[model samples]
Target: MLTFSFLLVIFLLTILLAVFDMMILDFSIWEALINLYFPEVATGRSFVYTGVFFGFVICIVGDFRLYKKKKLKKNHAERDGSP
Candidate 1:
């Protein structure tokens, strides 16, 4: 959950940065997304943008694994008649 929350914050910030680039820097939405994923075309924030996206994906996978682990634990506890 902590990882998810952190990634969520970074993702939101990335979105804001993209919007800022579009509004203030006159970048098209497509250009902004492309620049984020491709470092060669970006000024210098490519690492941050790419990291945020990949971190978001990792967060999702982590959350799913956590959920499954909790569910399995609960099932085991119920089967063993323990709290």
Candidate 2:
């Protein structure tokens, strides 16, 4: 329940950030992530773009959260296995 709410907030914020990036910066985070892995996708002034930055921020936050959850679960399982 708590994790679900946290994830929901994160997803909503990401959506808002993406919309802001598109409206203000004029680009899609999805497009930028593709361009990040494949530079040939979206070129020219790419370094100054917002999509890649937003994608990076969103991915990092999400990864950090999932890592925390995974670690917690693994520790729980280890303790359960111990005794």
Candidate 3:
């Protein structure tokens, strides 16, 4: 359930960011990501993609870490016979 919600939120936010990029920078999500690697080939948009990509990576990594920690704590509690 938590994973589902996280994915849903991420999907919606990614779409929102992509739309904003298109409206303000005139580029799709794919183009923005590509531009990060090949600036000379995919020039036009600003450096917003760098932040967006980094934010995405951070969010995903943080979420996974939190989920894993929670799961481990739950297992530990169960092993210790705690409620």
Candidate that would win on lDDT: 1
Q: Looking at model 3, report the run of 10 residues with the lowest lDDT sum.
A: 36-45
* lDDT against the true structure, each candidate: 0.79, 0.68, 0.71
lDDT of 3: 0.71
Q: What's the distance in Å from true for residue 60, model 3?
A: 0.1
- Residue 74 miss distance in model 1 (angstroms): 0.3
Per-residue lDDT of model 2, residues 1-83, tens digit only? 44455557867876776666667766788864444345655566567556656766676777789889999999999999995
- State in Å the error of residue 63, model 2: 1.0
* TM-score leader: 1
If the candidates were sorted by their TM-score against the true structure, best first, what order would they fall in?
A: 1, 3, 2
Those runs of model 3 whose alpha carbons end farther than 4 Å from true positions after fitting are 1-46
75, model 3: CA deviation in Å? 0.8
Q: What is candidate 3's CA lDDT for residue 77?
A: 88
Query: 37, model 1: CA deviation in Å?
Result: 14
